[model samples]
Target: EIESIANHYGWQIIEQEIDKDHIHILIRYSPKWSILEIVRLLKQLTTYRMWQKHEVYLCRHFWKERTFWSDGYFSCSIGNVSKEIIQKYIQEQGR
Candidate 1:
């Protein structure tokens, strides 16, 4: 899902790893890339896919609400951290 979003916006994924509850991926792209637009498209696509595939489950969970996601997401950049450090951190999680 994340990869698709990043790819649609011409972002490059340098590294990726998945944890129990979250995913960590290092992505880069042209300076003109709009983070907001990318995020919006991702959320929309995921929501649509989930709705189509999990309609019954979703309806059972909450008929009043229609959002698969809680609200927002977390994002940050590593300014001083080296690529090796980040890769090691992600790798260590797998062990």
Candidate 2:
């Protein structure tokens, strides 16, 4: 799903890891998109798809909530770090 979203937006996801509680993604996005916008769109699109695909389970667990992702997100610029290093970190996050 993440890959599909990235592709749809013409962004490249170099690496990604989904841990039990969090996710790490190394993405190369266009300058037109801000970090906040990227995160918001991802969470929104994925949440809607997930809800549609797994409505019963989500409703059972989140009876009072309508959101799947938390309101907070962490994003960083690739200023000093190399892309390889970031990709390695994201790949290792699930280990």
Candidate 3:
């Protein structure tokens, strides 16, 4: 679902992982897109899709109305390091 959404928005996801509480993604996006824009769009789409498919489960676990991800997110520029290194780091996040 996330990959599809990223593709739809023209973002290339190098690596991703979803743990029980959070997700980690390494992506390459166009210069026209800001970090906040990418994060916001991803969160919005994922929240809507998850709610559509798992409303009952989400409500039971989250106990909140229309909430999937947290209000805050962490993002950083991926310069000064190889993409492979970043991809490996993100892929190993849940382990």
Candidate 4:
């Protein structure tokens, strides 16, 4: 579902994983899209869809103004390490 939304907006998802508390997504986007823009779109679309599907359940757990993801996120430019290495690292998460 996140892949679909990202593709709709011209972002390429290289790899992804959803864990119990968070998600790991490796994306390649064009320069026209800033980090802030990409993050906003991803969070907004995914949160809206998730809330639509699990409003009651999410509200039960969150119980704070109906938010799914955290207001803050951690992101960094991919360099030095190869993309394959990063993909492998993400795949190894939660193991």
Using lDDT as the measure, the top candidate is: 2
Task: Give one digit per residue, the lDDT tens place, for model 1 in 1-95.
Answer: 66777777788888878777666666676868666665667778877888898999999986896776656767667689987898778766644
For each candidate, what is the lDDT? 0.74, 0.90, 0.89, 0.87
TM-score computed on alpha carbons, candidate 3: 0.91
For residue 77, model 3's alpha carbon misses the true position, in angstroms, by 1.3
TM-score, predicted candidate 4 vs. hidden true structure:
0.89
Candidate numbers, best TM-score first, in rank order:
2, 3, 4, 1
The candidate maximizing TM-score is 2
lDDT of 4 by residue, 1-95 (tens): 78898889888999888788888889999899898988888899888999999998898888868677788888888879899999998898877
Better of 1 and 4 by TM-score: 4
Residue 25 displacement (Å), model 4: 1.0
lDDT for model 1, on a 0 to 1 scale?
0.74
- In candidate 3, list every pair of residues with a backbone clash: none
TM-score of 2: 0.94
lDDT of 2 at 59: 98
Model 3: runs farther than 4 Å from truth?
Answer: none
